[model samples]
Structure formats: C-alpha cells, structure tokens
Target: MSVCDPSALARSLLAWYDRAGRALPWRKKGNERPDPYHVWLSEVMLQQTTVAAVTPYFLRFIERWPTIAQLATAPTDDVMHAWAGLGYYARARNLHACAKMVAQWRGGQFPDDEEALRKLPGVGDYTAAAITAIAFGKRAVVVDGNVERVMARLFAVTEPLPAAKGRLKALAAHLTPDMRPGDYAQAVMDLGATICSPRNPACGICPWMNECQGRRQGIEAQLPAKLAKPERPTRHGIAYWTARKDGAVLIRRRPPQGLLGGMMEIPSTPWRDDTPWDMAELAAHQPVAAQWRPLPGLVRHTFTHFHLELRLVAGKASANATPLGLWVALDKLSDHALPSVMVKVVKHALAKAY
Candidate 1:
C-alpha cells in the first residue's frame, strides 16, 4: 500500500480550501486574521452541536458580548439565560470562567500556545489545538470529527473510532503544513463535512480523491468505523408547577454541580431508574401545600446518558411565597436559565393549563 505524500495532500486540500471553504460566522477567509475570542466561543458552542444549529447562537453571543472583557463581566445568570436552549449547561459555566480568566487574570489576552490554552476552562486537546492553529496561526494538528473522518478515508484506516483516534491524530499531524495550518485544518474539515461525508461521499470532486485509500478501494463511506453505543436507560420523575394567582410560578435552583447544575427548575421528585414516583410520593415534595392537579400525559426528554419521563402536576397557590423556592412571573420565565428539560416541563404545564 502506497502512502499519500503529506505535502501533496496539504497542497491539494489548501488549494481546494482557497476555492471553497465553509463561510462560518467564526472563520476568517482569504488571509484575514482570525479572532481568538470568536474561535474559542464558536468552538465551545460547536461541541456536540451542528454548524447550522450553532451559527445563530454564535451571532447572538457575539452581538451580546463582543469581547472577552465584556463576557467576563456579564452576570452568571444572564450568561446562563443567553445560553439557554444551547444545551450542555456546563459549557456555559466553563466559557464564562475561561473568559474571566482571560480578561482579568491574563490581561484580556488568550494564550497562544496549546499547553497554555489547555489550562483554560472547557478547552481540551482538540479545542486547544484548534485555537493554537486557527486563532494564533500556529503549526498544530487540528483533528476534529470532520478531520478524523477525512483522515480515516484518506488513509483507509479500518480501526474503529475511540480506539483509532490516536492513529488518526498521528496521520493528521504528518500532513500539518507550517504554512496556513489553520486554513488546512478548516479545509480538511470542510471536505469531510461537504464532500467526504459519512454517507455517499462525493469522491469525484474531492481534492484527494486520487490519493484517498478508501476512495481507491471503493469504501470511502465505510472507513473510520465507530463502535455501537449501548441503549440509554430511562429514568422517571415528577415536577410540580405551582402557579400563584398572580401568574408567577414557583421554581428552585439546582445544586452547583452535576447534571443540570446551577440552572433553575420547577420542584421535582428525585429522578430514579428503579420505579416511577407515584403521585403520593411526588405530592410530599411539592413546594406549596396547594391542591396539586396532575397534568395529563408525561413530559419526556433524553439526556446524553438517559431518557427522562416527567409527570407534571399543576396547581394554583394563593400564598405569595413557598417555604422553599421563589415565584417567578410566567412572562419573566425566559429570563431565568432553564435547561431544555425544565423548559419542556414549563411548556407542557402551560399547554395543558385551562
């Protein structure tokens, strides 16, 4: 098996990139200097999210907080509210921490070196490498999911993912040219995303079609195999929507760590996998001693690890305050940082309200 020349691959991909690269909100085109702040923010938002889904959020974030200094000074609740619906709430926390570190501790400058970037909150190997290469124009191998797929197809690597990541990184490093390393990284990613797609890759137009081992073997779509994920377990719980006659809803803040931590949510029973919490058990944990009426049906949501089924109980409370939690006006609910699950709970409760 003949190995594709690294220099040749870089040249081909860079040329193709010059002609056709993704016009993303975070990327710079045609020799323009990349902004480290935009790069960091977009990369964080892009994690486990698609480009289409991230673009509007990226624009909104930049519009709201244009600089690291601005983002650092923003209130945590405000940041969380802005970050609502993006999911993966911890990223929002880490993003704020990283910004504060850069703005206050580091004098409003992002570290250019990969090692230093890694020390920042939420930045790992891939993110650090991407920032170093793209934002700082450093010579670092950036192997994201798209790059991994491109490299796997280019080399026809058959080792399954998670295990094959090291080999893919090594292969990608070999092709990392010092000149325009950032563009090369984005180019390879664009190729995988647009051309060397997982399903029916458009090899006829791919720059490396001639040299791609997987393409040559007529198995471009089958390279870079992944291990099958196990079925996620289902958990059950109940949430109470105790609304005041004034149209305010009772809500509480989650503990500062773990799943959906530091976010606002309606009072709910403990989420458990053993058995569904009955109405009797759920009623005992209600925020107010109102005549809670169980809303028909269930609110279901899936997390990274498990699926949740929540039974919602809505009732009107005459009291202004609960023993625990606070009453937030229904109109002001959007101001709070509610996770998708909790948002779903609110929507379900409201939709069923008579």
Candidate 2:
C-alpha cells in the first residue's frame, strides 16, 4: 500500500474543514455536541439521497417530532405519510423502528460506539460510524461514496470500484486521526463534492492538490473508475383503478414485505418482465371485480432495479361493489402514504377524466 503520515494528513484536512466545511442543519458549532436524534435522522435520510433533497425532510421531521421519544410514539402511518415523496420507503420504516427501539431501550440516547449503533435498524457500518464520530465525537472511520472517491484519487488507485473498495477503505481508515476525526471526514466529503468532483475536478484549488497522486499522474478525474452495470430491463404490469360513484378511489395497502411495504398503492398485478398481461391473466389479479375498460395511456415509473410500465384499467364501482380495499376520496389521496409511483398512477387516471 502507499504511504503518508496519518497525523499530517488529518491536520491539513481538519485545518481546511474548520474554515470551509458545510454548515449543515444537523451540524453543530465549536465545542458543542449535536443532538444525537438529528445526527441519526440526517444520516439515515442522506444515504443514497442528496443533501438538498434531505434538508427539507429533515427540517419537517425535527419540527414534527423534535425528540426521539416523540418520534417513537408517533404512529407509523403518520411517519410514512411525511416520508411519502422521499424514495426508499424501507428507510422510513426502519427509521421509525430504530427510533422506537432506542427510545424504549437506551432512554433515547444513541450509543457512542460503532458496534452498538449498527445494532439499530437501518444503521449499517457507514451510518454507525457517522453517528459515532459526528454525533459523539468518537474516532471512527466513515467511508461513503464521496470519501471513496477522495481516497481513490488521493492515492491514485487504478482499480475499479467494488473490487477497489477494500483498499480505499483501508487508506481512509489509516488516515483517520484521533484529533477532530469527524471534521476530517466531512472535509474529505466536501473536497470531493466541490473540488474533486467526478468530472472537471478543480485540482488547482483543492487543499490536497499537491498531495494528490492522481493529479500528479494527470488522471485526477478518472482515478476512481467504476465497473459498468447491466442495463435495467422494463417490467410490465396493470393497475386496476376503481372509483366509487361518490368519487372515492380504491387504495390498497401493500403487504408488509417486499417493495413498497406497508404503504398504500393502487391495486396492481405483480410486475413481470416476460410479457404484458392479457385480459384472462389480468382478471385473476384484479383487486375487486367490476366491469373494466382500458384507460387511455400507460403509467411509467423507473425504480432502482427496473423500469415499470403500468397499463391503467379503469372501472366504475357501485355502492354495493366489493369492499376489499379502503375507499379513499380522490382529493384526499395525499393524506395517505402513497409511493411516488402510485401517485403517478393517480395523476394518470385523473388526466384521463375517468
């Protein structure tokens, strides 16, 4: 492995961070410890999500609950509703579960070590390390995508990612100094987000420009190359949109497992990649049988793994129709915990004037 003085590197990083680090909402000023609740919530929300997207959600959550105890006591449905637009419904579920456990077991206090923190639901290694170092001032190595890129570039690592993650993590941990470790970690993140970006890195302005091996080798932007992923295949399904005579729509709660767990969604068949469901196949998967007709257009939403193409089948249900799902009024659909894809389905139905 390459060599550098850990202490000296951390000193430079902490120095730069003191003046230039982002003043995020969950962060605290000098000598003051941030509330562990804020740290845990923000860290969970920020995973595979952007800072801008998480900021408003964080603010709303803190304003609503303000404390771990309050969040624990809050209804899961309410929490899910607040997290409706935020993708990754599972994180919201796990966040609520973790809050309840922490409130009941530890008296609303997060553990100061990485191991204990990881025991909580939704808190993986990176999140545990972040809460430990950032919230509790403990020295733990925190490696996210930003830090991975920074380490790969600083050491001029030529290996592709996933395969290169172990070496990159070791390099990051080796440089993690005891003094102001949290600030040092954030500093690296800031450097990567702003200066050492994936494209057109401002090498001349980076604080570690001179120390960066990748820059010296004239491949700063390409140091951390990633393996190409396979193209996401498109899956087809049909959503049955049945509206009552009083303008109420049928919304069903997805089963408490798999994708969109515990969230409300329009009734749909299992998404399959093989072929579009025909009338005979679609009849077997209907939420409740009514005289059905095809809607005007398709409702499309891309998920993390595959692109979903949902054909809308509309029906008018009488008062005596089968009461299989909740009859939610169209205007009040926002009150329920509808995933973004379901919301798109609702909008498509309304635009069709059905």
Candidate 3:
C-alpha cells in the first residue's frame, strides 16, 4: 500500500481516471468545458434512477429542448408528458420550474456557486456541488451514493449508513484536492461505480487498492453497512374508467400538490391504507352516474414510500357532457401528461372493456 496521504490518494485516483473513466453523454473529453445545463439536467434525472434508464430520456429531452431557454418556454404539460415512465413525476415539475428560473430570471445562465444553485428547484446539496465542480470547474465536495460507498470502504467506516453519512462526508471533503477538482470528482465516482461496487468489489485493479483501509482489513465489501429497511405499507384505491359512446375518456388533473400532482389521471377514490372493497364504499366515489362494472385483477405499483393497488371500474357515460372533468378522445390520450400508474389504469380498463 502506498502512503495514506490525501494528496497521494487524489493523485493515484486521478491517474487511474485518465485511463479508465466511463464514457457518458454528459461528460466532456480532455480540457473541454462541460455545459452546466446538461450537468443539471442529467443530475436531476439521475436521482433515484439508473444511468442506463436515464440515458435515452436525457437524449430525448436534449433533442426536443436543446437549451435551458427552450425548456423554460415549453408548456408544463409537454414536459410532464416527456417525463412519463421516469417514475418520479415531481422531478419533472421541479425541472421545468428550475429551468424557467434559470432562463427567465438568471438570463439562461446557471449560478456557478453551490449556495446559489441550491436555491433552484430540485437542486439539492449533492447536485449543487456536482454542477459547481463539473460544469464550472470549481472545487466542491460532491458526494452521492457511489461516493459514500467509496469513502466508507477507503476509510473502513464501521457505522451504518444514514448514521455514518456525516462522517463520510467529512472524510470525503478532506480528500478533495484543489487541482482539477472536476476530474478528481468524476474519478472518484467512476472508481466507486466500477471498482468499489456493492458486491464483490474489484479491489485488485482499483487505484486505491493499496491505500484502502478496508482492503487492508479484508472488509472492503462489508465496510459501508446499511440498516434493514422496514416493510412498505400497502394502500388501496379504485380508478373509474368512464368512456362515452364516441370513444372519449373522462380524465381529470390531479391537484398540483402531493404525489403525481399536476398529472392527468382517471377520476378515482382516495387512496387509503385501509380502503374497503365494499360496493357501497366504492360507489360513493364514482365520478358520474353510470352502471360501473369492476374489472378483474388490480393495477399494482410501488412508490418510494408505499405499495399501491388500484381496482379498475369500467362504465359507459350516458351523456356527452363530462360534468366532473375533461373528455379526451381515445386516440389523443398521449397528448395528456398522465403518470405511469394512470396509464396502467387506462390500459387495464380498455383491455377489459365490454
């Protein structure tokens, strides 16, 4: 193992990065400067999402709205529709809001400083630090899930996650060098993702293998311990699928506040932890007076906090007038910004239509 000095560690990691850094769409080669807009967009999409899953979406977004100004000028519904299947709908809303703030208020320029960047919607600590370091060529302690694992393994941190995050951040900050901080940040992230993986880490090829305290102790794989996650609570609801004779569907916009807010959805009963399946309880929340028939099976989805099971009820609306919500033509369903859950509800109801 080489000396356990911070400078030595930084030098070793950056040298390895020069040879083996992963090629990503958001990254720049050699001395080329990175675009802050791209960095912010990619970082926001990466939250709670994998890189493989986000790559196509990122490309699609860039192709459609090439600049922050373009994105800011786009309709909110358009952005929401583009963000369909990304799971977290709130990120899409915040991304649009942040882009508008940057374009309209800041004149299409992102603030280079971490503190100022954090004020933007969806720009958290890690994201702010990443944008400052990578896009603006500033020194910032950028820590994400990958960095946490690398730091925990390198320092042989024994405390479980959530509890050890503070200590790990401090250790990471200590190792952050002043020279080429952006490359160094990317290097560490690459090392963690490729070498210090969660299971069966490739310690032999790691640049910091000799310097890793966990490797010396033969506990690299088990260094960053995590507490057991509690069982997620299951919630139940019923979605009403009312279709007119002309093939128009009744859909409503969710209140712009909580989960799946501002997204289009079929009218439904409130999701509750103990919702009863009784006919009387389900009939009360029906959107219009119709002979509703319950579809077989349930539309199940998992959110960050809970599991949701939605029952689908299909019925024919007698009148062309939709008193509760808008009547969208079946062919134009894609025009609305419906979340994945609502899309599933619609598909299930259509498949079982009489």
Candidate 4:
C-alpha cells in the first residue's frame, strides 16, 4: 500500500549501476540498444543456471549464431552439438525450435509483447517478460530469484518464499517505473547479485540501504524465508557396455526429444519407477567373460527430475553387434557427443577394466 517513487528510485539506482554493475557479455554497452536475440538467448540459458556457469555458454552461442536468423537456420544437430557441454539438453532443443519459429514464421523479428513471446517454444513467463523489457524497453515487470530475494528483503518480507512469491511479485510490480523499466530491472538484479547477496550481504554498499526494511529491522538474513527442499530419493538402473574385439565400443543415439536427447550413450536398461534392472536381462545381453571384463563401480548421476544409480556391465565380442547400437573405435569416444552420465560410466569401466 505504501507507494514508492519508482521514477526517482530508478534514476538514483541507474547512477549507482553505472559504477557497480558487473560486466556481463549479454548486456548492451553504453548508448547501445539491447539486442533481442542476445537477451533472449541469455535469459534461456540462465534459467536454473548460475551467471558464472552461463557466461561461457552465452559467449559460445553468440559466436556461433551471431544473429537470430543465423541461429534460426541452423540444423538441430548443430545446435545440440553447440550445446553439448551445457547441461539441460531440453533447453537447447527448445531454443532451436523457438529460433526457427521466430525466424521463419515471424520473418526474423522477435515479438515485443510478453504474451506473444510466451507463445514461442521454450519461452516461459519470466523469460518473455525479461526479454520484452530488456530488449525492447517495454514496461514489463521481470522477476527472477535475484529480484525475488531483493524485494523480499527490501520490505522485510517474512512470508515464506515460493509461498510469498506472489505477494513479492505484486510488490515489485508496484515499484517498477513507467520510464526506464529495463534499467530498473537490471539495477535491482545487480543489487541482489552483489550488494544484497544471499550470504554476508553488503548492506553498506547497497543504494537501497537507507530504505531496506530488513536492515532497519535487523533481520536481513531472515526476511526471505524459504521452505526446505524435500530429500532427493536415489534410484538404480543398468547400462549394457558391449565392446567388439575390433576395438569399437557399442553406442546408441538417445531419442531426439527428451532428457539426454540427441546424444550418444552406452545402451541402458529402461529407466523407470525407481526400480533396479533385472539380472536376467543383463545376462542375456552382456558380452562373453573371457574377452570382456565386467567392471564393478556404480555410475551415479543426478538429474533435475531424478537421481540415477547406474550399473555398468562390460564384455567384448568378436564381431560387431547387429542390433541397436553402433560400433566405434574406443579411442574415438571424443568424436561422439556423449552425455556426462554415460561418459562417467565409461570412464569408470575403463579405469578398472585393465
């Protein structure tokens, strides 16, 4: 209910940001208009990823694509390859689809409206709003973890986060200036990332320190209460590692549309229901004893959806297996784009095989 003068706040914060904002690759430099493609791409990569982790990927993507039209015309495989090292393969797939849609269907123009951007593949509410405001200078309220945290502390919000997120967002919208909404958005984000950090916040350096309710109340750390995350349950699965005496490893392409999609991996038993793989199935598909060694360590990996505990059973065959997987020289592992989970399993098997 307390209306802050958003325009004055934005102008003051913009002055501070000129000296304090971190140099990020995606941002528009002095006097330059923001690039919609760069903003959109950075926003997509930043979801569920930290700024440090996304910087390299953003740079690489910009170098590779350079323009929205270039990215739009790229092959799906090439996009996937470009995003190989980056986790969250689904984002890359969605990026490719969105890029193509925008370039071909929209005639190489990005939608400035948040609602229209949301209609694009992989563009969510936050991303659409952020891109709209930052790239096109639209009056859209952008909310991310940084913004949420900053807002929560500014007003000394005590409502638990996630649960309190709706209220916080409403409050943030109230503080967004009609003019320079983009600068205000970036300023608040910079404040959260640096001065208002999650731990050991630098309140002394914050421009909003005089007005921060959390600091005034001596509860800056406690303002943003978040519910504890549920413990992640572990599950087990098996992977079939078949190597031919011709020195080739059996590799299969994962289905092109889901987790680990469009990548190579050792043949894995079905991952499902938090269940262990059947011993009988492994015996039937596993290679002969003399030529191959069944390496003993478990390949444990964590995914956003679930934790995977994988067993690797290795064996060598005289001839290449005729069914699903392709045989490639063991030394050529670098050529194929294997998910890190599969790579871990292979490395574990190889380390102890000899």
Better of 2 and 4 by TM-score: 2
Question: What TM-score against the true fold does each predicted structure earn?
Answer: 0.96, 0.96, 0.95, 0.90
User: Which of the two, 1 or 4, has more lDDT?
Assistant: 1
lDDT per residue for candidate 4 within 1-354, as digits (tens), equals 122765666667788988877778998777576888999999899888889989998998899889989998888877877777678888988998999888888887899999999999889878988888889888898998888998898888998978998999998898887776677788888888888899999999878788788898999987689998777777777777776766677888889877898887888667765677766666555433323334677888898767888887766665524656677888888677776887797798777665
Q: Which ten residues in a row have the lowest lDDT in candidate 2?
A: 1-10
Clash counts per candidate, in order, are 0, 0, 0, 0
Q: Which stretches of candidate 3 lie over 4 Å from their true place?
A: 1-3
Error of 4 at 226 (Å): 1.8
Candidates in descending lDDT order: 3, 2, 1, 4
lDDT of 2 by residue, 135-242 (tens): 888899999999999999999999999899999999999998888767776788888788888889888877787788988898877879899988999999999889
Question: Who is ahead in TM-score, 3 or 4?
Answer: 3
Worst 10 residues of 1 by lDDT: 1-10
1 against 2, candidate with superior lDDT: 2
Instruction: Name the runs in model 1 displaced over 4 angstroms.
Output: 318-321
For candidate 3, the 10 contiguous residues with the lowest summed lDDT are 274-283
User: How high is the CA lDDT of each candidate model?
Assistant: 0.87, 0.88, 0.89, 0.81
Instruction: Please write out the lDDT profile of model 3 over residues 1-354, one tens digit for every residue.
Output: 354588988998898999999889999899898889999999999987888999999999999999999999999989999998886788999999999999999999999999999999999999999999999999999999999999999889989999999999999999999989789988988887788888899998999877888989998888799998999999988888888988888998889889998889999999889664665776688888788888888899898889999988888889745558889998898888888888888888878875
